[model samples]
Target: MTTKPAIIILSASALAMAARLATELDGEVHGLRKRIGDDAEVTFDDVAAHLVGLFREGRPIVALMAAGAVIRLLAPHLGDKTREPPVIAVAEDGSAVVPLLGGHHGANEMARRIAGLVDGFAAITTVGDIKFGVALDQPPEGWALANPETAKQVMADLVAGASARLEGDAPWLADSALPLSEDGGIALLASDENVNTPVSGLLYRPKRLVLGIGCERGCDPAEVLALAKESLSEAGLSAEAVGLVASIDVKADEAALHHVARHLGCPVRFFDAATLEAEAPRLINPSEIVFSEVGCHGVAEGAALAAVGASGELAAPKRKSRRATCAIGRAPHPFTESDLPGRGRGRLFVVGIGPGSDGWRSPEVSQMVAASTDLVGYSLYLDLLGPLAKGKVRHDFDLGKEEARVRHAMELAGEGRSVALVCSGDAGIYAMATLVFELLDKADGPEGLSDGARRIEIAVSPGISALQAAAARVGAPLGHDFCTISLSDLLTPWEDIKRRVRAAGEGDFVIAFYNPVSKKRRTQLAWARDQLLEHRPASSPVILATNLGREGETIRVVPLGDLNVDDVDMLTVVVVGSSNSSTVATGDGRTWVYTPRGYARKEGTAMTNSFSGDAA
Candidate 1:
């Protein structure tokens, strides 16, 4: 779960308190629309549905309302308490803080923290927290509860005046106010072993082990996972003890390494070659061949030592399958995410923001932009992100620098930074997604990508393209067979483009023309218009959608015979209808274009009659 909570306020009265909490918690304020001013980060019309949606997404929520109201809204969705995120209800006047759900999962702590900030009382009602000052079911970070089902009975006994004894090394628990005795009735065992002796008390596993892995390019994920499990079995260490998976930076994009980390239920971190090579003296099986390939003497063992720090030791020697290697390092104590030194595997999210409109932008694109540490795009594309662009490192490029933007995004990710390469409309349609792969495909050429850049993970999140937006506004222009063609001859030869246009026209495909015209380039759109008229009727409907999903947007339809190059620009998408397409005037005196997909042929068929009867 994210550390940043969602501070939800329902009225203007709670706006000041919500703003204070948001600033203190590094959270975003979600306010009720029209009830609060623009000071809130986001405004929603429906409070109950929005709160439930945030709860379902596992985001911690700090709602400034009555505790009963929050409970009433979320009562129907409540089930597993273990999986629910922290839900706290703070009074609108900031006088009281009540943890209504997930009391053991940081809710109580957050309540107390917020109460202290507002000079109010923390109404923590959990018996175990009040008596022992610790939640046995939900242990601290980097510690896993081996048997959580037994925690309720154990906590009940402890709350019923039964003393407990600590049986292992746990510095955090040692400071808690639990009634500890040598011969107590209940025992708390903390160990890295896979204990399965039906303990009478809670069994916790301290995550002190770091699993290091390395594999050849395109290694099998199953092979790496099996080797990791076998190495853990041989070392007598529990999988719960693995706090992190470490590897050299060059294997950051390796599928097998990520698969193993997922199987182990831990995050994966990567060290650069220089950092991994610093542990050469401690590698159990150093190899010069490994150094020649990835600049590290031993990928598995060196990464393990590099992650475990100098005081740690190699708990398990290097083990290998056919194409993968695994090693284990043990720290003296459990470690959390902040304790790890190396950066996580870099990821490049190539996302399309969808024509400068928040309504047209997809939720996935918004999430990708939120998760990114750096935003790389043309200046206009980045500006379209609005509130989501706050606090992100922006790298703006001018027009005609497509290769430069992609290369810079890849380089930033190679250094273990989360990057978002922003584009307009759909990322896969005439956008940066193709350029990213083009560079990756030529990673070994004279002016190719760096070794680290070649290994960064890349994902493309699509958005509504200009063709789809234009087609939707004009009504069904792309409902039938269609193709998209770019008219710019800067990258491709004009002869080839003309060949595609002629083929599309002959094939009776509705064509959406992109890059229809530029300031210096002309005659292409007019020539194409004339060429398309040869195959189709001169009365064919042609749509010129300009500045779609933005200010000063215009959608105009003209005949194929009247399609002048002066009406088209770089921002306009020209859609020429097929030979069989038609336009009709509605009752409201508006023109609607549509291409019939042979539905009229089935009008008298039995299948159509049966569907009509079913609808009736």
Candidate 2:
């Protein structure tokens, strides 16, 4: 949920419905400026652009609008389904919720969750969701699917009415609606076997093995490994099933135990002696010497049962070398997110720095950057924060390699490192946040990811947008109503940009043109100017702000009729006022641009005696 920005979009007439949806989903409501309700987080004239902005930011959108409207708006901008964010559309009357674009990417789940808010049904289109009520490849919570490919074929077999064989001791499979038979057509085997399963088998690996080891202070690593491996082999257990290694805390750093864990590729855990002692009754063989030294009757078996919790079964009794002892216990359920820390689950922070200025940076963004072990971004952006980059490993790429930069950051994070992907402006707005999500979506963590990479946590810290900075530089040019449209059509089509600009103009909105003019691309701004001129007056105030929030900042206001196109560059933001905007001259002879918020002005109300009689 933290990874994706969830939003709800509605029209002026649906403010009441938007309120309920926002409260239930913990999301923001986007509507027109005229609908100033408690639910509105943002308001704009061009609804399609607002929706596209959310989509580009990798946000999950629950739009309370007609399906056809959303479809037409999204039709041109739709990209890869795996990378696309969830887009759900609900009727204004709350009759039903439909998963539109990203059903597998969690739109169906989001739709179902929000459906209960209005007592509506989720209109799921996927066959797996509609028939079986769950994605067969996507395992249940807390369970990891060992072979996602096998599950697909197995499910296909069952869907075709062929008998399937359900093996192992998973109790849930008994109640499941799987087409089961002893004489197998397809195999759904839930076992702790370390050996590879047949291609025809959908192996559901259970959290069955709890390896207990008690090693001497200077025991040989070879002996510890041999003993643990022999014990697992004697009990016919798979090494992958060994979810934990339980022993006394004093043995936490024991080299032999560490070597044993490294061999099995699991974690080494410790419980105090007294906690192990309480499990003495469950131990198959109690030790008086162990009790006297560590206050536990049994170190191996006792710790094994303790780690597996109360609902565990003793799978392996005690086995011993000359200096070490081992035991195994089977847990009822598989290992979960809580157990992942020991298994090297990583953390990634996508941070925005706000228009190349430190003063405008958020505290949370700074803290995250300070805490990061590795910082990744464009070399110039990294150079802007020279002080923060000290002592941290930095991976800087040239501009236009954003995908490579984000990919490198994810790789570092997946390796159990704390990484920060530094981006300019708000992380969600035209930055790396969306790219990170798109890569994660392609990896299909829920469907299948390596155990270590599967648990990596993702978060984004926002920064001030360049448009806001430009708007603030000039006085209140964005006070009443405004929308930002990027003039650089590198990723977006020129026709789409024109359509959005035309929409903003027709609605009489204050327009903020970002990436207005660059060296390579220069015609879009002129084209936009011509299109907007057809709707607005020639004397509309246009605020031109360049190099804002940085050194050598400059701001000027020009009428739309005389906007200097040659003076504007990529670093400049062009804000064109609506029909209601006006300019005022101050005593210093400088002018200010402001748009009225429609507050009622006092009729004929002025100061009676202020300028002439100061000291009466």
Clash totals for all candidate models:
0, 1
Candidate 1, residue 82: the lDDT equals 93
lDDT of 1 by residue, 1-616 (tens): 2446999998888888887898898787888877875556666778888899889988899999989999999999999999999999999888999999999999999999999999999999999888778998989998998889999998888888898888889877789998889998788888887676346887788898998998999999999999999999999889988988999877888888888888878889989899999999898899999999988899999888988899999999899999999999998877787777688877899999898776688767877887889999999999888767877999999999999999999999988888999999999999999999999999899999987788888889999999999999988878789999999999999999999999998898999999999999998999899899899887788899999999899998888877788988889999998876777666775777788786646757321111111110
Colliding residue pairs in candidate 2: 194-238
**Superposed Cα deviation of residue 362, candidate 1 (Å):** 1.5
Span of ten consecutive residues with least summed lDDT in model 2: 607-616
Q: What is the alpha-carbon lDDT of model 1 when measured against the actual structure? A: 0.87
The residue-by-residue lDDT of candidate 2 on 1-616, one tens digit each, is 2332344555567777876776666555566654543235445556877688778767788888888898999899987766788899898888889999877667888888878888888898877666655665655444446777576676666677777687886665655666677997677777887656767777776755778889788899999889988998998887767766777766754678778777766666667788888888898999899888878899889878887888887789999999999998888777654553122335789998887765677757866876688999998778766555655799989988988888788878766777989998889988899988887777765543443344466889989888788777667778788898988788999889989999999999999898899888878888888888898887788888887777788887777877768979877888988877777667775666777776425566431111111100
- So what's the TM-score on candidate 1? 0.90
* Candidate 2 steric clashes: 1
TM-score of 2: 0.45
lDDT of each: 0.87, 0.75
